[model samples]
Target chain A: MSEWWSVVETARRIADGEVTAFRVVEDMLVRITRVDRDLGAYLEIDGDGARTAANEIDRKRKAGEKLGPLAGVPIALKDNLVTKGIVTTAGSKILAGWVPPYEGTAVEKLRAAGAVILGKTNLDEFGMGSSTERSAFKKTKNPWDSSRVPGGSSGGSAAAVAAGLCAASLGTDTGGSIRQPAAFSGVVGIKPTYGRVSRWGVVAFASSLDQVGPLARTVGDAALILQTICGHDPRDATSLDVPVPDFSAALAAGARGLRVGLPKEYFAGELEEHVRAALDRTIAALRDQGAEIVEVSLPHTHLALPAYYIVAPAEASSNLARYDGIRYGLRVEAPDLLTQYSKTRGAGFGPEVKRRIMLGTYALRSGYYDAYYKKAQQIRTLIKRDFDAAFESCDVLLTPTTPTTAFRFGAKATPLDMYLADVFTLSCNLAGLPGMSVPCGLTPEGLPVGAQLLGKPLDEVTLLRAGAAIEAAVGLGDRRPGGFA
Target chain B: MPTLTRKEVEEIALLARLHLESDELERMQSELGVILDHFGTIAAIDATGIPAMTHAVAMDHAGPFVSLGVLRPDEPQPSLPVDEALRGTPKRDGDLIVVPAIIPGAKE
Candidate 1:
């Protein structure tokens, strides 16, 4: 068996009797053991649980029963997604030892699809930071460059897939969590339309903005995983009650005759030279393939980051108010309930979490509500309108996923500097559009650069079609990080 | 950009129910001030005619399948088992999670 097997190949091989599910899972376990020590991609490696599930898949196959689409595929979940009977922590000391009694809807869907639960991957504490550096546990290193951070709050999921620790992993995106990390790690990550996936048991982080998606080696793998997880769920009121489209069928449509819009505001900023080159390469590839590339404008792009900061943190502050230490997490004893709440939270949350909570609380304060929170919401409307207008002229919009390649640890000295890392990816979340990052090419320094595709609401099909085209044109196939490979 | 005072940071922390050390409070004051300053750009935007988009489904482009509001029939459903509900509580007395006294000067 090859070490770097794509999710599609893994499932097909296992289904065709070319490989046993047990053997596939065992190989993944061995690879994770060998590779994950330096990467810190997984918070927990559920070897026993994964093997048990693999054995079940093999049994079902031997019994001549039809298997699910992801049968025998080993996948990891971002720790923020709860798994019943597994110790699930949102990379915060607050949830350090909490074992969820219920599983997230996505995890349940993955299990039903016969995907092996490899374990939960690390994330920014409560999905708060752009880089996994803010995780309360071990920081996930970029598989491409150990010295640099794996972009986060989905950093662990992206790194794991890049390192071949798992076939693919589920990552939650609020602002740019999943896509940014996938870009930095050189993998395919998609943030489905906000209401497309149910968020039932996932840890709440800026509830309105959060959406769970897959990070994988190829766009098809992501589509398969997304197919299994997305649908209307009564448990998640915000879930869209739309029929799931056949994404795999859509991939073959390619970029021909597609109207790809290049958002002018996205290109107006100071992008790193390598990133700019990669974007140009992607645009050229699409145009060469008969995709009509037109320049479009999203006038309110500059205000996206500012509005996101206010909106995400404001919602986070309210959603996180449930962790009062009296419930299902770490508790600090104090003479009074209020003091205990304060002490527990102070001790549990990391610096970034505290900072966001403070900022959010202040924004939602009585006198400042209209100025900060309300104003940000209004700006959100303008951002959404900008996308709506842009989409009218084009089938999809393309841009660089990040302003630069992955940076060295501690390169972003200030919180604001770190926040800027997600500037290019934030507007999509605010507008609730489906966004994907596909690797375009490697920089001169050997770091991978990604090109982002933004689609209209619930239009992941167009993004996938364009992404697969980019994937083929770039032709960076089966590339693995040096040491890991 | 509005700079937060030390007192303001402390007040906000209290409101957020986070106990901060003196050093952390100082750090937060400076950091929050910088972020708020950046947020001034959003404040400067003229959005007089725009309505606040509290949810993504509120957008006109959300498509036919998505409803602005989803209402499930209100019916009795099986809740989490008592043991499961209390499974992760830090301090539990039987099935009930234990908490500090809500009233001041109350005995434990």
Candidate 2:
């Protein structure tokens, strides 16, 4: 099997009897065993379980039964997404031993589509930080450069797909968790418009902004997983009731005559020379393919990061209040009742979680509520307005997914420095807009760089179309990271 | 600037039911102070009369639609037993649940 055969392609091969699902699963396990030790992409690997499921899929295929798009494919789930009978810790010690009785909505969808759950990948404790360093268990290293970060809180999922450990993985994007990591890791990721994918089973970061997305080696693979997962779920009240389009079909439409708006502000300030050059090359490639590139301005782009910090943490502070060591998590021994609450939480939660809780608690506090959290929401409207106006002039927007390529581990020590990494990707989440990150090029150091495509709400087809055009133009998906097999 | 002292940090920690070590507390205090100071960037921006939007869709949940069974209609549902509910509880006095002695007036 070729290393670059996406999950969709592998499924077709299995269906055609050219290769069995067992062979694909075994091959993936062998690769993971060979590569994941150095990558730190997976927190837990379900080798035996995956093999069992794959064997079943192969049996069904031999029986001449129809299969799902992801049938017999091995896919990783972000640790935050609860999996039945698996240790679903959101990369935090707090939920270290918590095995959920029920699986998450998206995981259920994947199971319905016959996807073998490969394992759970590491993430920020409750999806907090941009760097996977915030994970209490382990830091996921970048596939391109081992010393650099793979981006987070879905860093593990991105790294797994990038390093070829898994065919594809699910990552929750709450303010760039999915897209930024995809950018840094040199893979494709899509955070569907808010509510397009159900959030019922995923651990909440910020309820309003979070969405489960796919991280894959290619945009088409990402879209295949997305089409399977994007639909209304009675379990999630906020889940969108939009029709799920055949994203893989849309990807072949190409980028001809598409009005791609390049937000001017995203190109300036903190954009590395390499990133700017790569973005320019990507835009030029699209232009050559008959795409109409226009310089459009999202005037309120600068306020996105600040507004995100306020609103996300405030919502996080509320959503995370569920984990009091009283529901499903680690429990520290203490003498008194009160002491138990204090000790369990203090010992279990990582520093980043505590920081966010504190920030959120303060933001939602009564005396200052209107001044901070409330005002941030108002600005969120203005930010959405900026995108709404820009979309009127163009079908979609284009920008660098991240300002720079992957940075070395511990490179961004301060909080704000790491927060700045999401400057480009956060607004999409804030506006409930669909967005994608596709590999554009590599830095001079050989680290990967990615360009982002933003589309109108519930218009993932446009996002996928532009992504496919760029993916074909660059042909970066077939290229593995340096020194890989 | 939002001046967060060691006392305020201690208070917030207590409210959140977190017991921090002395060094951890001090470190958090300093970090929180720096972050709170940065909030001035947002505070400096003029948002004079804009209405705050709690939800992106801005649906009124407290209205008559709630009574029409749209907003979290109450329905009796099967759940785990008392033993199962207490299974994850860190502090359980036999069948009775226990919590911290939160001083009501102290928080205010």
Candidate 3:
């Protein structure tokens, strides 16, 4: 099997009888078993489930039945996205071994599309922090350098794709959870416009900002997954009523004649020299390909991180109030009911989760709500307006996905330090626009850095076309990190 | 401004229902101070007259993409068995799933 065959390519080959779904599943299992020991990307592997699904797809193909578009392709899901039978921990001991009775909308979509369910990848506890180090279970190591981190809260999914544990994975981005990790792991990750994908089955970190998206080896694969999973669902009140575009078709059209905007504020900070150089090179390549590059300013960019911390945590504090050791997760034994409640919660949640919850509670409190949470919401509007104004000038905006490559484990020890790690990508979630990260070039240390492209609302097609052009120019398709067993 | 005194930090921890190590509480007090310092800047932005933009721009209507439906379904569906529903509970002793007391002001 060729490593470069995306899920779409593999499915085509399988449908034509050139390859069997079982063959692909077996190869993935071998790769996961061989490499996942060190990476710790997966919390649990559903070998039997994957194999059974592949076999069923293979049978249908042989019988001349029209299979789904992603038939027989293996995909990993972030632990936050619920599956009926598989454990959904959201990378926290508080919900350890907790399996939801209903499948999430995205999971149901994948199943309907006939994709094989490989396993659940790890993530930050309740998707709270920027680094997966906030995960209560285990830290998902960077495949590029085992000692460094794979950026998070979707770090595990990004690491899994980079390590070849799975062809692609689903991750939720609420303030750069998906794209930051994608940048650090050198993979393609897309955050659909907020509410584009239903959030019914996924565990909520911040209801307003959370979005389920795909991380893959190629932009087209991510697009294919997005097309299948996105749509309005009655269950999610915020879900958008919109048409799902044919992203693969858009990819075929390429990025010629597209006007790309470079946000000046994104490049002026302590951004690593390597990342700046890589984006400059990518911009030159896009210009050479008949695309126009223009300078755009997002004046409210500096307030994004501050606004995100307040608004997200406030919503998170409200959403996570359900986990009070009452329904699921860990419970501690104590003398009386009050002691039980206090002790159970005190013992269960990790440090970062506790920190976020407290901050959120304070922000949402009676007197402070208007000052903190409400004020942040006003700024969030300004951030969105900045994007809208930039889009008026250019069809899309470009920025470095992250400020730097993956940092060594324990690099950002303080919680506030970790929150700053998502400086570049968080604004997209706050503004509710589709954004993506594509590999541009490697750093002096040979670590990969990614350039992000932001498209108009519900304009994932434009984002994918831009990404495909960059991926094609870089020619860095399907290069797994070194030392994979 | 949120000062986040040690006493307030402890109170917030109790309210959040998460146990914090002593060192963590001390550290959080200082870190929160730094964060609140930054948040102070955002609080200063005057948005008195601007209307709130909660959701992004709505998607363009190409056709009848949204299907209107009634709220209630007359048909009933099979539900999980009581025994099976409580299978993974941490502290279920009988038909009822046991849990920590949820009464507000019951604990310190």
Candidate 4:
């Protein structure tokens, strides 16, 4: 069996009895042991649990029972997605050994679809930072370049998929967590429309902006995973009851007769040369396939970063208030309850998490609410309006995912410099639109460049169609990191 | 650019229920000031008559992605067992989570 089998093929072969699920799981476990030591992509590896689950799949197949769509597929979840019995840290010291009593809605869906849970992948503490360097345990390095960071806070999931650690992994996006990391790691990542997937039991970051999605080596694999996880759940109030169209079916629809818009504001900024070239290549590819490329304007793009900083942190501050050490996770004792709350939180959270909590608290404070929080919300309205207007003329907007490819560790010195890394990708989250990043090409240095596709709300089908086209055109076939391969 | 004072940083930290060390507080004052300064640009935009967007979904009653505020029917569903829920707590006394006294000068 090839080490780099796509999720779709892996499932098909296992279901058809061409390969035993036990053998597939064992191969992935061995590969992870060999590769993940240097990459640090996983926080936990459930070898025993995975083997037990795989054996069940094989048993069911032998019993002549119909298998689920994702039968025998090994998948990883970002640590923030709580698993019933596994330790889920969210890469924070506070929840270091905390085991959730119940699994999240998405995890439940994946298990029901017969995907074996590989284990939890590392992420920035509470999904706060753009790079996984903020993870309290260990920094996850980019698979492409050991010196560089896997774009985070979904860095582990992206890197794992890129290095073939697991077939596909789930990642959460607040601002650009999923897509940015996927871009840096040269994998396909999609942040489905905000309400597309239920967030029940997933650790909350920024309540309004957070959405769970998939990262995979191929767009079809991503679509398949997405198809399994998405649907309305009564447990999460924000989940949309809208019908989920067949995403995999839409991929074959192609880019023909589609109006692919180039948002002028996205191109107006100083993008690295390689990123610009990738964008140009994608535009040309889609045009060749009869997609009408048009220049569109999302005028409020410049304000997106600033607004996102305010809105996301503010929501994070509130959502993260549950971790006070009294109920679960790490507890730093004090003489009084109030002091205990302070001490426990301060000790449990890392620097970046503290910085965001402080910023968020200050923004929501009495006199400053109208100035910082409310004003940012108004700007968010404008940002959403920008997309609303642009979508009127286009099927999807195409742009560079990040300003540059993966950067070396410690490259972004200050907090604000690190925040700027997400400038190009923040608007999608603010507007609650579905956005995807597909590896477009490699730079002169062989670093991967990602082209982002932003679609209308609940329009992931269009994004998938366009992404599959880009992946086909830029045939960086079965690309793997040299040393790992 | 609004520079945050040391006292303001302390106050915010206290409000956030995060006990920062003296050195951490000093660092936060400088770093958060720079971020707040960057955020100052958003204040200059003319947002008169604009409604604050607390959520991303539009309030339209009719559309493909319409807002349905309907909640699930209230019913008794199976919840985690008592021991299961309390298992992860750092300090627990039987079925209850143990914590410092809420009232000042109270005995442990």
The candidate that wins on lDDT is 4
Per-residue lDDT of model 4, residues A1-485, tens digit only: 44589999999999889999899999999999988998999999989999999999999999999899999999999999999899999999999988889999999999999999999999999999888999999999998899999999999999999988899999999999999999999999999998889999789999889999999999999999999999988888888988999999998888899999999888888899988988898899999999999999998899999899999989899988999998898898889998999999999999999999998998899998998899999998898889999989999999999999999999999999999999988999998999999999899888999999999999999999999999999846766777677
Which segments of candidate 2 are over 4 A away from where they belong?
A: B58-108
> Is candidate 1 or 4 superior in DockQ?
4
Off by over 4 Å in 3: A1-4, B53-85, B100-108
Candidate 3 chain A lowest-lDDT run of ten: A476-485
lDDT (tens digit, per residue) of candidate 2 on A1-485: 53458887887887788888888888888888888888889998888889999998988887888888789888999999988777789999988877776778899999889898989998988999887899999978988888889999999999998888888999999999999999999999999987788888899889988999999998889988998888877677777555788788898898899999999999868888999999989999999999999999999888888888889988988887777766567777654657777888889889988888888887887787877898898888788888989998899999999888888888887887887778899999888889999999787788888999999877899999999999888747567887554
Clash pairs, candidate 1, are none
Clashing residue pairs found in predicted model 4: none
lDDT of 1 by residue, A1-485 (tens): 54478788988998999999999999989988987888899999888999999999999999999999999999999999999989999999999978999989999999999999999998999999878999999989999999999999999999999988889999999999999999999999999999899999999999889999999999889999989999988888788878999999989888999999999998988999999988998899999999999999999898899999999999999999998898789888998988999999999999999988998999899998988899999998899999999989999999999999999999999999999999999999998899999999888887889899999999999999999999999846867788687
Worst 10 residues of 2 chain B by lDDT: B61-70
Best by DockQ: 4
Whichever of 2 and 4 has more DockQ, that candidate is 4
lDDT (C-alpha) at residue A378 in model 3: 86
Which ten contiguous residues of candidate 4 chain A have the minimum total lDDT? A475-484
Chain A TM-score across all models, in listed order: 0.99, 0.98, 0.98, 0.99
Comparing 1 with 3 on TM-score, the higher-scoring candidate is 1
Checking candidate 2 for backbone clashes, the offending pairs are: none
lDDT of 4 at A54: 96
Number of clashing residue pairs, candidate 2: 0
